[model samples]
Target: MTMSDDIVRMARAWIGTPYQHQASVKGVACDCLGLIRGIWRERHGTEPETPPPYTADWGEGGGQEVLMTAALCHLMPIDRQTPMEPGEVLLFRMRPGAVAKHLGILSAAGQAPRFIHAYNAHGVIDSPLTTPWQSRIAARFHFP
Candidate 1:
């Protein structure tokens, strides 16, 4: 199977994992970034590095591009203008002028696109990439 397909399959396997900040264990608990880190482990063996402890307002408080910076360091950065495709990692800003902090793995691309993410209080779910959500996308990357 292609690497993108492998990523989608692995990400889907984490479905139902509860959201737990700073945790990356599949099925047990994981936050948005945790979900990405877990997938990285599954696809590429060891993680490049472990993330430091972070609060809910981690990037917001510091105005640091923590998530985007790490992603650029480990993943293959993709042009934001390029059409999003299945298995791509999506970085979201969450709000205007905020650092890109949220992450999700695109599961389907074309029309009615969907992505899987660990939503707080809701666990991991494949959510529709609705217009509102689309507008929040700040960057995209492919697993290296």
Candidate 2:
């Protein structure tokens, strides 16, 4: 299968994982970054590099594109202006003037695009990419 297909397959396996800070386990728990880490491990055999401990306001303080930089280093950057397809990884800015800190895997396209992501209060779940969510998207990438 294609790498994107593999990514989607692996992400789907994390569907029921409980959301937890700094956690990464399919049946147990994981956060947004954890979900990406898990998918990377499954596809690439090992994590490209270790991540340092980060706070809840990790990049918010400096408004740095920490996650975006890491994604460019490990993942293939894509055109954000173009329409997104299934299996693409999306980086989102939760709000204006805030660092982009959220991530999700696009799972469907066309009339109603859906994405799967792990949230703090709610575990991993797929939600439609409604208008509100679309406006927050900052970038998109694909697994290599």
Clashes of each: 0, 0
- For each candidate, C-alpha RMSD in Å? 0.9, 1.2
| Candidate 2 Cα errors over 4 Å, as ranges | none
Winning candidate number (TM-score): 1
Give the CA lDDT, 0 to 100, for residue 31 in model 2. 90
Q: Model 1 misses residue 131 by how many Å?
A: 0.5
**Runs off by more than 4 Å, candidate 1:** none
Query: lDDT of each structure?
Result: 0.92, 0.87
Tens-digit lDDT track of model 2 for 3-109: 66777788888998999988888889999989999988887789999888877665798888888789889988888677788899999999987888899999887
Q: What is the TM-score of each candidate against the true structure?
A: 0.97, 0.94
After TM-score superposition, what is the CA distance of residue 80 in candidate 1 from its true location, in Å?
Answer: 2.2
Query: Candidate 2, overall lDDT?
Result: 0.87
- Give the lDDT of residue 15 in candidate 2: 91
Pick the lDDT winner. 1
Could you tell me which 10 consecutive residues in candidate 2 have the lowest summed lDDT? 50-59
Q: How accurate is candidate 1 locally (lDDT)?
A: 0.92
